[model samples]
Structures are given as structure tokens and as C-alpha cells.
Target: GLLPAMALLARTLALLAMTLAITAIKVVPLDMARDSFDDQYRGCSPAMMAVLPALHNFEFQVNPLFTQTWVKAEAEWRKRGSPVSPLASPAQAVALMAYTTKDIYKDFNAAVRVAGHSRQEYRNNFHFKTLHFLLTKQCHHVFRGVHDVRFQARRGQKVRFGQFTSTSLSKEVAQKYGTDTIFEVQTCHGVDIQAFSFYLSNQEVLIPPYETFKAVLETNDIGVALFLNLVLFFVHSLDHLGFPKLLPLSPHWKVSSVSPGLNVIVHSSGSFTIL
Candidate 1:
């Protein structure tokens, strides 16, 4: 935990240094995290943008590097008037930075999980909503027609990815992650970030969080569908077991007599119809 925290702090300090160099500012205190944002990232309303900086000094602290990347990317994105690069948008870069910072991402995910649906009901919700928008938008278009390459590994197991995933079109890269005991990832999503990525070759593709996923891939949809499916599954499984059912169940929640299973079919509308 200390190592990760120290790493994030180092990155944050690097970003702050970069900002200071660019602006030629004499002093920028850590408390002024909100002021660290460049004026260029105006894609979101002041209110929405406010949420990010507020995170720095509050209960949830984020890396300043992320905010800087977002600002720079957003400025470039707006100047181009369209998303030319996959990770050009501020939101997209921010998403990547957050994912890179393991601790922050984990904590953010936990908070979002706790908030659940009530978080969405708040029209003013910015932090989680912004991240949701960023990840979902970029993921939807990643790895369009690329054939899934077989890893040397076995059939079913987990493969861990670092902050910036290093992948390649070459099978050798895949083989590095594969093992005799571990199952190869048959289906995965990746994007060529050579244009935007630093010090990376064109042959390397960055594997995002949704790489192993086949369906309900978008982060937003997955979270909602998974939660709903679990709740419904738990209720129906109990009903089948002849246990006392919980009250305040949604009328729209169609209860089944089937045993607990996670066979959820997510529609394009982000609604899951479990069977």
C-alpha cells in the first residue's frame, strides 16, 4: 500500500513540476489542487469540472498528473473539434490515468460500488459519472475487427495487467503472459495507442480493462447489470429454496422459481433481462 501511494505521489509531483515549468509559477501549494487545472478543459460545466479538483484535498485524493493529462487532452480535443485519437479526449486520458493509478482506481471503484443507483439519481454527480462516460465511450469502439489471438496459456484463469498494459500484434507478447497452467484469453479488447502513448512502438497495443470481456463490456453497463443480476439472482435463488422472500421488491422485478445463476442477457439499452 505504501509503495503504491508513494508511486502516485511521485507521479503527482512530476505533474506539478511540469505545470510549474509551463506556467512559470513561483509557488503552487498542494491545497490549491483545484487551481491546478488548466482553463482549456472546459468541455464540462464548471460544476462538473469542479468535482475533480475538489477530490484532491477531500476524502478522495487523486493524482495531479491525471488532471493535467485531462486538461491537455481536452484542450487538444476541443481544438481539433472531434475525437481524432482514441485517447485524445480529456475524459479518455483521465480514465487511463485513473486506471494506471492502481490504488486510486480501486478506491474509486469501491466508492462507486457503495453509491450504486442512488449516485446516478443525483443530476449533479460528477466524479463517478465523468469516469463512467470516459471509459464507456472509449471502450465501445476499441478492437473492432481484430481477431482474438490465442495465448499459450490454458483455458480459464486470471491475467493481471499493470498500469499501462504492454501488448503487441506479435504472438510473443501474448506468450509472455501465458503459462502452462493458466488459460489463454480467447476474447479480449485492445487499442493501438501508438499515436498518443509515450515511448511505445506502433506494434504495441494497450490492453484496456475490458480486454477479457465478451459482452456487457462497457463499465457503466457492467456495473448496473451485475448489481441488478446479483440482487435478483439472490432473491430468486432463495424463493426456489423455499426461504422467506424480502419485502420492497420492485414490481417490475420478475421473480423466477429457478435456482441462482448469473445468466444475464444485457440489452443495448443497458438493461439486463436475466433468465
Candidate 2:
């Protein structure tokens, strides 16, 4: 009898240890969980990660196709011995794209559709049309001082074809733009960079921008932590009730082994039946 009693006691202790272990295992650390969430949210592809830095750098350079008109104009400016303002860099282009209203792109495309015939004409038309839109938007802060740079254009000539000279923006000109607008332009630049990288390396997977990914991670962290804590609470409650060790008694009996030669008899009915 003494041997059986000791064996039962050892089995109860083992069951309690197992419950504790389960609870411990499910208790995820906040930082580790957040990191995991971020990785999943971003769809952290090795390929994308490898190329992200280079892509960001590329954003600071002008796209050849987009800036071809500006290039042509800059060459003439150089020939005239005037200081040439650089074409909108890639980051500036994307920032303009992001900040510009959708109607401008739509109208430009429509105009190109109507008047564009040859490939060269289509390319030139797009560049010229985009140049007009950029000028009209007056996104000087997005382009920095590039907008203030004046060019000498003949009557009816597009601004890109003129001899240009770089100039600094006056305080009055700078005061016209708000800090928030500049911040928005910068934010859009970052979004475009993320979009470009996603398209280049992860076309199949939909990866969100970094800011969106962070927001999703923060939201998921709270939910995951709550769920894990709830589970831990349930397990602790079960352990307190002596679950898997103590059971209800009934006429219909079920036997479980607590230890070798130690049996726990439980009944489905509301009665305690211990053997």
C-alpha cells in the first residue's frame, strides 16, 4: 500500500511539472514575438533584402527615359556655358508621381494617345507632358532648389529645351511651402522605394511598405500576447483543479495510469470514484 501511495504521489508531481512546462513553452517573449511578426508581415525575402540598399541608392539617380528631355536641355545649357540645373532625380520623380493628383497622369496619357504616333514622338510627348505637370505642381520642396533654377526659353518652347541656370530659392518662395508637405513628399518617396523593390524582387509576394508592416506587427503583437496569456490562464486553472489526476466518479468506470501499478479510476457521472 505504501509503495502504491508513493507511486501515485510521483505521478501527480510529474503531471504538474508537465502542465508548468506547457505553460512556460506557450509564454512567448514580447520582443521575440514582435520580431517574428515583423518578418512575416514584411515577407522577408532574402532576394529583396539583398537588393534593397542598391535600389534605394538608385532612387537618387534620374531614370534615363523619364529625364531624356531634361538631359537634352542640360547639354544645351552646358554648351551655352550656363550653370545647368540637374534633371529631377529618381527620388524626386517618384515623389512627384506620389504627390501629384491622378488626373494629371490620366490627362497626359490621354493626350499622348491622341497625338502620339511614332515611338520617339510618344517618348518625347510623355517627357514634355510630365515636365509640364511637374512645373504646374510647383513642388519646389520635393525637388529642393531645382524648381528655382531658371532657363532661357524662346517663345512657345518647352521649359526643358531652354538654357538653364541653377538658382537658390528666396525665403519668400520657401515660406510658401509647409513643412508637412515636404514631409509627405519624403514619405511618398520611401513608399515608392518599397514599391519598386517589391516589384523588382518580390512580384509574386505582396509585401507592404515598411510603415504599414510596422503597424500590422504592432496590432498583431497585442492580439498574440492576449491569446497566449489566455491559454496560460486556462492551463493554470486546469492544474489547480488537479486535471488528469482527479476525476468525477460514476457507475461507468475509466482507468488511467498515474504510475506503474498505480491506476486512477474516473466516472463520467458526477461522483468521485478513486481506486
Candidate 3:
């Protein structure tokens, strides 16, 4: 009986990885999509222990294609004297891909909103926690002065962007999402991923999922005010009942502008980062 249960769990994980890989390149309508890929595996039951291994399997299946394309992009950026974010390690790239592309088959913008909101309860989720660690730790550098665009009109809300959200060095890309109503977001924790996203041109800066921001500034522009928010990044040292410690941030290394485009970034790292 126990062996059969284990086999079933294995099958479930494999199915999940395969479906995610399909969504990576397929196109689906927003009306037919789930909020987040992780929604199906939220509660931490005993079988939930298999999630990390499943993520590892996902990475292994996808890394060859990702790295083959990414290495060329990394070299190109290096030649241009604008290197990719140090946080865009091979493993981290896959994590971001899983989260960002999970709903890519649906409407991209709607996918982002749903994924970010759905991740609010993922603090205990092994996939997200590993992603958090990769962005906050392991990379050895702190990110500051990143920008993003949101379609929502959250002028006075205390916001917790609950997933690996994409930001950028270029305001032009942020401005593209809105015509009359736009929410311009400025924060301090973003990793440059132009290298990892070889197929994209946007100088993508990714905000880690483990921080809090309070909308502090709103301009008088016609439905196009800049919502500059100060962000504080923190890390949990223990799993259960652990206090959060604020991560150190650098005053420098903020990119003001880059080549223009738009892209959404999200997801988790590999087995090494997973518990």
C-alpha cells in the first residue's frame, strides 16, 4: 500500500512537470487558466515533501535548452559592457522561468497579476522559499533602484508583491503597459536578467517575492502618476517561528535606463536551494 502511494506521488509530480513544460511554450486563454501553477500543491502534507524533487526534475528537463541560449546572451551583454544580473545563475533562471511562464499561455498581464496575488500564502512553499533565498542570498550582491508597471490603481495600499515579479532598468518598458491609467513602481531589490532571458530584449530586473512595500508617492499626472515605493527586503533564518532579518542593500548599482521592451519574470531554483 505504501509503495503504491509513493508511485502515485511520483506520477503526480511527473505530470505536473510535463504540464508546466507544455505551458512554457503553449498559448492558452486567460479564461481557462488557474491562478498559479503552485495552487495545486499549497498545503504541506507529508506527500508535499515531493515538491522539491519535482522542481529539480523540472529544472533538469529544461536547463539544457535554457542554458544553451542563455550563455550566448550573457556573452553578448558582457561585450556591451552591461553584464546580466549576478542573481541570474543557471538554477535561478529556471526558477524564474517556472513562475513567470507558468501562466504565459494565458494573457501575459493577467497571468502576472494572478500569479503575484496567488503567491501570498507561499511563504512555506518550498519552491518559492528557494527562489527567495536565491535572490536575497547566494548571489552576494544587493539590488537597488528597480522600476515596474502595474495596471492596478493601488494608490494608498500597503502592498506585498507575493512572487518573483519583473521590474526593469528602463521606465519606457514600464510605461508601455498603461495608456491613461498606470501605476509606476520603484523599489530596491531587482536582479538583471537580460542574459537569462536570451529571447527577450527588455533589460529585465526581477523583484524577489519576499519583501514589503508601501505606496508612498503619487504624482498629479492624468491617471499616470508615478507610484514610488520604498521596499525593505528581509530573510527568515528559521522555518518555524523565525524572526525576519533585513538584508543589506547597496546605495549604488541602480540602472536608470536600457534598451526598451516588456517582459514578465517569475519562479524557483533547483534542488540545492530546496530543503
Candidate 4:
């Protein structure tokens, strides 16, 4: 009689060899994924999601004791501040200059005409909208007594950045010049408040369907590799009793047209079944 036990022995050997030959291995870790620089150490730390019954704390923790070094010189800027053609904060200049004119609306129209020559989009967007909201929402008590100021930026027109920007801004500067709550909610991760400012001003609009490519990756990345590995593991299972791949991704295998059941006893070593 053909030995049913012997065939099981062969399949286990093949599986073990493949698992051992894999090129990379990694373990998933919990991380907080903080969104801004203003976040403080007292709050934004990572912890496991599972809730336990009682209060708990761990005393001993390992620290590698690594430190970073930097020169006294200015750090690299994320977004340039000085006047640049077209994009040199057309909105801010317009907003400020608009204040000096008797007819605010007429003054802004003229300012846009002057500034729009550089970059109509910036003139159109006006300081990315940060300082615009500073005027609205009663950002500071100082605005109350300043002047009877009235301004407008069209919110209708569409643009690539709903609030997102190709530009990056420092969290330090954003906090100083703009409201922390406004920028924190509107801005994306890393420095760059230009998009948020533009959005609030209603001058520029975010590109439709902008999120589809936000963090797109090529086939070479580690996340892709891990997914491919799982695919290989399932496709190569020649064993008659091995569980099907679909069953793992979904547990509703019993209702499906084709679903392989489990085998808990098969393990392979050299020539004999190891488990």
C-alpha cells in the first residue's frame, strides 16, 4: 500500500526549507505617529491599544543612549520665507496694504492687480490663508479695535491643494504667525503651513482626488515585499491537507464553493517529519 504517512513527510520538509530561506524578517511595533512638532513629551507617547483591567506601569526600560549633533548655523528651511517671484505671500501683502486704503475692497482689487503680475495664484491665495483667519474668528482681541476692515477671497475656484501644498513650513513659525488649532487641523504632517493658509483665505483650492498618491510606493518597498511573501506561501503549498489562502484572509470558508480544511500534525525536517 502507498504510505499515506510518507507523503505527509515530504510536504513538511519542503515547507520548512522555504521558511528558513526567507531573506528578511521583521516584527510590528506600536507607534503614536505624532502629527506635529508642537506635540509635547508629556502626552504623545505610543502605547498598545488593548485595554487592561487595572493600572500598570513598567519600571525598567532599555535606552540605546543615542544623541544627535547639529551646527550653530540655521537648520535647513522647509519653505522659503523671503520674497520669491509670484509666490512671495501675495495674500499677506494684499491683506496688510488693503488696511491702509479708504475703500478696502477697491484697494485690494488694485493690490491684486499689482501683486498678481508676480504670481496670480499667490495673489489669489494670499498668504496661504493663515493670517486671513487671524482676522476672522476673533483670533486676537487686538483686531476688535483696529479698524472697520472688510476683505474677501473667492472660495469657489478649484486648485491642486485643498489645503495640502508642495511647500513645507516650519511648525515653529506657523505657531508664531498663525493659530495652532487652525494650522494643526488644516495642515498635513511635517512643516509647511502655506497650503493651510491658502485654504483658509479661500484664494486657492485643493486638487480633487489629491489623496490617491499621497504616499504611493513602488514594488521595491518592504511593505510590498511582505505582501508578496504571503502570496508565495499560499501558492506553493502542494500538500493535500494544507489550509487554503482564502480561508485565512476570511473565515467564511464553509459557505464558499472551494475551501480546504486544516492539518495540525504535519511538520518536516530532513528526511523524517519533525512534528
The local distance difference test score of each candidate is: 0.33, 0.27, 0.38, 0.21
Q: How many residue pairs clash in each candidate?
A: 5, 1, 5, 16
Output the better candidate (3/4) by lDDT. 3
Q: Estimate each model's TM-score.
A: 0.30, 0.15, 0.40, 0.15
Q: lDDT tens digits, residues 78-182, model 4?
A: 132433233344432332222222223232233322322222332232321121111111011010000111111122211111212221123333333332111
Q: Model 1 Cα displacement at 142 (Å)?
A: 13
For model 1, how does the per-residue alpha-carbon lDDT over 172-252 read when each residue is reduced to its tens digit?
Answer: 443444321112122234455444333233244554332232222111211101110000000000111121233323554
lDDT of 2: 0.27
Give the winner by lDDT: 3
Residue 86 C-alpha lDDT in model 3:
58
Best by TM-score: 3
Write the candidate numbers in order of decreasing lDDT.
3, 1, 2, 4
User: Ten residues in a row with the worst lDDT in model 2?
Assistant: 229-238
Tell me which of candidates 2 and 4 scores higher on lDDT.
2
Clashing pairs in 1: 154-182, 154-183, 155-183, 188-211, 189-211
**Candidate 3 wrongly placed segments (more than 4 Å):** 1-55, 58-89, 94-157, 218-275
Write the number of the candidate with greater TM-score, choosing between 1 and 4: 1
RMSD of 1: 19.6
Tens-digit lDDT track for model 3 on 181-271? Answer: 2334455555556565533655666664443455455334222233444434332111222123322223321111100110111123222
Question: Local error of candidate 1 at 22, Å?
Answer: 46
